[model samples]
Structure formats: structure tokens, C-alpha cells
Target: MVIAIGFEGSANKLGIGIIKDGEVLSNCRTTYITPPGAGFLPKETALHHRENVLAVLKDAINESKIDVKDIDVVCYTKGPGMGAPLATVAVVARTVAQLWNKPLLGVNHCIGHIEMGRIITGAKNPTILYVSGGNTQVIAFCRKRYRIVGETIDIAVGNCLDRFARILKLSNAPSPGYNIEQLAKKGKKCVTLPYCVKGMDVSFSGILTYMEERAATLLKEGYTEEDLCFSLQEHVFAMLVETSERALAHCNSTEMMIVGGVGCNERLQEMMEIMCQERGATLFATDERYCIDNGLMIAHAGAEMYKSGIRMKWEDCTILQRYRTDAVEATWRKD
Candidate 1:
């Protein structure tokens, strides 16, 4: 009976989870965005985590109705995130583990997402479409390792969404990503945006600039905002779909799984599902609990590692700003 606690502050979201064996006992998450309602701000992010990490952790434990003394292990995200925020989580988890005399395991944020996706989709060797404000990639497992087949050269898909949402003044009144999706629904016309595809690498900054210029021109002519949103979603989603399909073809993997923040988009999931179906590929997603950045993913992953007697040394797990997904070695015991 291995009970584990997981803390995550790797992104704009704060998550805490308690796990018993391989099942989640309780999972909690709270979101805090940046100042001026823009993208994630490191200073503000650190401050937010420092302020609320403890409350969220305690609340999660209470809500889960779990006893702290039963905890045998503790896990915390160590890197691949805002340094300030990740540090905040590490400090908290370290303190808690120290207090309880529990051994702490430092988890990789990207691998956390991938492991959660595996749990959600149950796709043993699926081709991965991972996109977020921080990462955009086409990945697959090979030779006991995750390989990055393709990715964006500049600007992740979610960052493009957030920036465009700011450009349209959609940050305050409603959620930026959700608002942009709504606007895209109202858009009736399509506008041609720059498509930069270099082998497997795609660049969204150039497309973003073109769309911004075109949007300004349209606004000058009183063009509808809905149409602009629609065109943008169409073009961006098409590019993603094209690259995903190409990766699938290259890998010859017919199973597709999406992970990351943007993976929450119903529209994106629908598009990927349709693409996967076209090629007779099966697609699966999280069952709410593992969908967003929740501590459950980390705890669940840690529980798996703990069961196998795998652990990370505190001195070895460094915060990585430009860490690639393929860099981490896989520990899954293939039966």
C-alpha cells in the first residue's frame, strides 16, 4: 500500500494530488495567470506559487480525506517550467517530505504530461501530438525512448493563441483560449495565412505576424472579428493536422494521443480525431482528472516509479528551460 503525494507548479496552474497505489485519492488544481493578462510572467508566477502552494496542498489532502502519516513517498515537479515557480513547488514538497521523513522524488514536467497521456489514452505506443504555450511537438516512443519527430521552430501553438487573444482584447472578460475558440466559430470566411513547413519543423511566429497584419487590414475595412478567428483556427489547425498525419505516416503508428494545455481544446481534439480516423488510427484523451496540469499525473507517475524502486537524486534533477522531450530515458517495464 504505497501512498504518495505530488506537487506541481510548473506552469500557470498549481496542482496537488494524493495517490494510493496506482489510483488517485485526491487531485486539486488552481490557475493563476500573469499580469496585464498576458502570457505567463515568471516573477508573478513565482509570487503566486509562493503565496498559495501550501493552502492548495493542505486543502487537497483534506479534501481527499487522506492521512498524512500514511504517505510513504512524496513527489514534486523539478523542472521544464518557470524556474521561480518550479522552485516554489520544490521547496514546499521538500519541506513536507522533510517533516514527514518521506523520500522525495523529483519528476520531469514533460514526462509527467506524457505519462498522464498514457494513462488517459491507454495507448501503449501511440504517436504523440503534444502542444502547449511552452511546447509543440510530434513525438513517438522508440528503442525504449521518446523521440521527437517534429516540432515548431519558433512559438508554440498555445502561445500563438494567447497572443492573438490579447491582440483581439479577449483576455479579461473571458478566458483567452475559450474566447478565441468562440470567435473562430463565428468566422465565416477563410483568409490565407503563411504556411511555414520545413520538413517536420513548423514556425507560427511568421503566420502570427501575417495574421496580425491581415487582421488589422480587415479591421480597418470593418471586417468581422468572427471571420478572422475562424480563418486563424482553420489555418493553424490544418497545419497541425498536416504535420501530425505526416508524422504518423513516417512513424507508421496508427494510434494518436494529444497532450499539453492546448489539448483541452475540444476543437483541436475533434480535428485530431477526424485526422486519426481518416488513417484508421485510434485516438484517446484524458478522463478529466488527467486532462490539465494536475498533481495527479505526477503522483500517478511517481507511484509507478516507486513501485519499481526507481528514484531521482535531488542533486541530479536540475531545472531545464530548453529541455527536449526525447532527452529523458524511459523506465516503463515492457512485459
Candidate 2:
């Protein structure tokens, strides 16, 4: 039984997980809520990571009912995340790997999300709707790697939600998107917002700006804020659902795994699931434990790579803020 400890520090949350043979022992998260008016400032994120990494790590290990010594390998997210958060987690992974004389696996942040969705839902070869603060993509597996079938040309779905949440003065604490979803329940969708999906790719920056302007106008015009919030969620999420359906149709695959922070929205999942049902495809959606960023996915990716005898040279291992999901060189799969 290979026991592994996973560290997810690629972004705002510190996700730690204990797993063996794809079976999760424990998964926990410590969310880093940014200060007001500060949207994921790199220095603040790094500082927060440095302060909480140890506590989160120890708690995860303790809660797993497994000894730290039993961990056969240490897994850490490599990139496609904030540089400071990734570096902070990398140092912890490096230390743990060194101390135990165990192998260290550097996992891709996006792959972690994808893999975790697969593990949670038991969906094999499912297409993916991966949207987050940094990424927006419609992906499918092919050629031993997930291929991007479509994506955003600009900002991600989650970023748009958060930006709108701030525009409405919703809490940036805990989870902004989740908060936005809550406020959306009270919204009446009064104003019409732009929805742009071009050839499998979507753009939100323009719509976001348009909505902001609309909201400002409505507010000055004595319209209720709830009406604006309602309109925003409906339009934004409708765009997401439409894009996902388009991807599902374009790929001709019904199996979709929605992975990322935005996946937590019940509305998004509901629409996607309905689309799949209509198309006779399966849609896999993981819970917060796996859906949100976490370390276990990274560890699992690392273990798979290591078992296949793939190892990255120390000199070549560096943090990447931008990595194409399909750009994975190789998985070290022996098959």
C-alpha cells in the first residue's frame, strides 16, 4: 500500500490530502480570503501560505488516522497557479521528500482538478469543463493527455463571478463565487447582459464591463441591487452552460467532468447535467473536497508519473504560472 501526502498550494487555498491507490484517506482545505480591495495579491498570498502551511499539513496528517512515516511519497502542485503559493508548497514538499528520503511528485494544478473529478465520479474518458480563476477550457482526453477542445480567449468563469461579486459588494471572504451564487438567489435578472460564445471559445471581459456599467446605471436609476445580481448570474452561468453544451456537441462526447472552483455552483452543475441527459452523456461533478483545489490530485499525478519511471531533473523543475494543459511532456505511463 503506497501512502502519499499531497500538498496543493497552487492558489488561494491550501489543500492537503492523504491517499493510497487512488483511495483518499483524508482531504482538507484552508481557504485564504484576500483582504478587501486586494484581489489575490502575490505577496499577501505567499505570506499567508507561509504562516498556515505547517498547521494545515499537520492537521491533515493527524486527521487521516495514518502516521506521517507511513507516507511513501510527497506530492506537491508544480504550476499553473500563483507563483508565491506554488513556491511555498514546493518548499514544504521538498522538505518532506528529503527528510523521508522518499520520492517527490510535482503535479500539475489543472491535472489535479481533472484527476480528482475522475476519482470522485469514477468517470473514465470523460470530457472536461475546467474553469477557474486562471483557466477556462472545454477538454477531452486523447493521446495520453487531456486535449483542449475549447476555452476562453480572455478571463475565466470564476474570475468573472468574483469580479461581479465585488462589483455588487458581496463578501470576498471564504468563497466569492459561492457568495455570488447565494446572492443570485435573491436577484431577479432584470437587466439583460451580453453573452458571447464564439466558435467554442468564450469571452467575458467585455460582458463583465457591460454588466458593471449596467449595474451602475440601474443603481443610479433606483433599481434594486438584487435585480442586477440576478441578471448577472443568469447571463454568466447561462453562457457557461451554453459553452459546455457546445463543447459536448462539438466533441460528440457526453461524458463531462466539471472541475474547478466554479464547479461548486449547483446551477452550473444542474444545467450541465441536464444537457448531458438530453445528449445521453454522463456528467461527473465532484464535491468541494475534490472539486476545489487540493493536494491529493497532485500527489496522485506524481505517483503515477514516478511509478512510470519519469523524473524531472532538478534544474528543469521550475514554477510555471502559464502551462498549457495539453503541454504535459509525458506521464511516464509504462503502458
Candidate 3:
């Protein structure tokens, strides 16, 4: 029985979570939202995290009804994110660990998403489709790590969507991607767009470039924004589904899991469900609670590693901007 507190501020969102054993007790977060046609800057995102993390942590603790002293371990995302935001969370985590006299665990942001997906959906040994603003990969447990079977060659899916939203000056209230998903629902026309998939990998930069040109031309030509949104989602999601199917075929696995910010798209899920149905396989997914970046995942994954005796000192909490998913040794999974 272990109680753990986890902090996550790897990107635009700042989150705090508490976990007891393998179950999530509370998850609280605040996203740093930029205005339309804008993207979040590292420094600004870091400042947002610094301002809101403590309050989020307090809320998490209060919601969980757990004393700070009862927490056995402190965990925070250590890598594969913006340096400023990562450092912001690390400082808070280290400070809390020292103040509470608890051991510290540094967790990989990508692994946090994967582990939380597995725990919430109970999909063992499934092929992973990790699509986010910074990352896009198809992963599976190989030997002692999550091996990347397929991935993006350029920008990620979520990055493409965000940039497109900026081009159209779309609102960033909830999220650019979510807004696009809603616009896509009102589309009936399917305009042609580039779908680039090389081997088992996918690329979104070319698609984004083409979509930008089309968006400008079509908007001038009295084409609806909804049509462009629909076309973009259809083509890109098809590419992703195709790549995932190929990975599943190569691995001969009957289960597939999607984890990341873009995983919240209903069209992506619908396309993936069709793919799974055709292959007679099961699809596993969680709602945005576990799909999007959150401290709950950090807590759950770090707690697992900590229970396995993994610990890190304050001096060793270095953060990486491009930590690969396959780099970490998967100590928790036997397969």
C-alpha cells in the first residue's frame, strides 16, 4: 500500500495527482491556453505552471482527503517536453519531496501516458498509438522497453492540427484540436488532401502545408471551414489507422491502444474501431481523463516504478526535450 503524489508540467498543462496503490485518488490540472492564431511559448507555459501548480496540488490533496505526510513518494515528469515547463514542475516536486521527507521518482512523460492507458483500459500487450503535439509513435513492448514500430518523420498529428488552427485563427479556449473536431462534425463535403505514409511511419508536415494552401484558397472561394476540417481529419486519420493496422499485422497482436492528446478525437476512435472490427481485434481507449497529459498518469507510472525500487536523487533530475519512448527500460511489465 503506497500513497504517491505526482506533478506534471511537461507542456501547456500543469497537473497534480494523488494515487493509492494502482488507483487514482485525484487528478487536477490547469491548461495554459493561448489566444487564436497563437501558440504557447515555453517561458509563458513555465510561468503558468509555476503559478498554478501549488494550488492544483492542494486541490488534489483535498479531493483525495490525503495528508501530505501520508504520501510515501513524490513523482514528476522528467523529460520529453519543453525544458522550462519540465524544470518548473521538477523544482516543485523536489521541494515537496525534501519538505515531506519522501523519496523522489523521475518519470518519463510518454511512459506515463502508456501506463495510465493500460491501467485504465486493462489492455495487456497492446500495440500503442501515441499521438500528441510533440510525439507520434506506434509502440509495443519488446524485451525490456517500449519499442517504436512506427512513428512520425516530421511534425506530429496534434502539431499539425494546432498549426492549422492558428492559420485559421481558431479559438484555443478548450483546445485547437477539439475545436477542429467540432467543426469537422458540420462538414459534408470531403475535399482532397495529401495523405503521406511511408513504410510503417506517418508524416504530417506535408499534409499541413497542403491543408494550409487549401484552407486559404477554399476560404476565398466560398468553401466552408467545416469542409476543410472534415477533409483534414478524414485523410490524416486514415493514414494513422493504416499505419496502426500495419503495426498490428507485423506484431500479430489482437489488441490496439491509443494514448495521447489527439486520442481524444472521436473520428480517430471511430476509424480505429472500424480497423479493429475488420481485423477481429479489440480496441482499448480511455476518455480525456487518461488520454490527455495529466499528473494521474505520472503518479500511476512512477508509483509502479518506485514500488519496483526505482528512485532518483535531487541532483540527478535532468530533463530531456526529446526522450524516446524506447529509451526507458520497462521494469513493470513482464512481457
Best by lDDT: 3
lDDT of 2: 0.79
- Compose the digit string of candidate 2's lDDT tens values, residues 1-335: 67778898877888888888888787877888975545777778888888988898888888889877788878788889888888888888888888878777777788878877777788877779998877888887776777888899999988887887777777778788887777767875468678888887889998899977777778888767677766777777777778778877877776878998888788788878888898898888977767788877877776666666677666555677787788875454211
Runs in model 1 deviating more than 4 A are: 34-37, 172-174, 287-289
TM-score of 1: 0.93
Best-first order by lDDT: 3, 1, 2
Candidate 3 stretches greater than 4 Å from native: none
Reference-based TM-score of each model: 0.93, 0.93, 0.98
Q: 1-335 in candidate 3: lDDT tens per residue?
A: 98888899999988898899887799998999999999999999999998888789889999999788889999999889999999999999988888999999889999999999999999989999999888999998889899999999999899999999998899998999999999999998888888899999898999898877777888887779898889899998999999999999999999999999999899999999999999999999878888889999999998899887777766887677888889899887796
Clashes of each: 2, 1, 0
Encode model 1's per-residue lDDT on 116-202: one tens digit a residue.
Answer: 888767788888888877788888888766789999999988788888877776763334666788888777777777878888878
- Candidate 3 has an lDDT of 0.91
Question: For each candidate, what is the lDDT?
Answer: 0.80, 0.79, 0.91
Most accurate candidate by TM-score: 3
Model 2 misplaced regions, further than 4 Å: 329-335
- What is the lDDT, from 0 to 100, of the residue 7 in candidate 2? 90
Residue 38 shift from truth in candidate 1, angstroms? 2.8
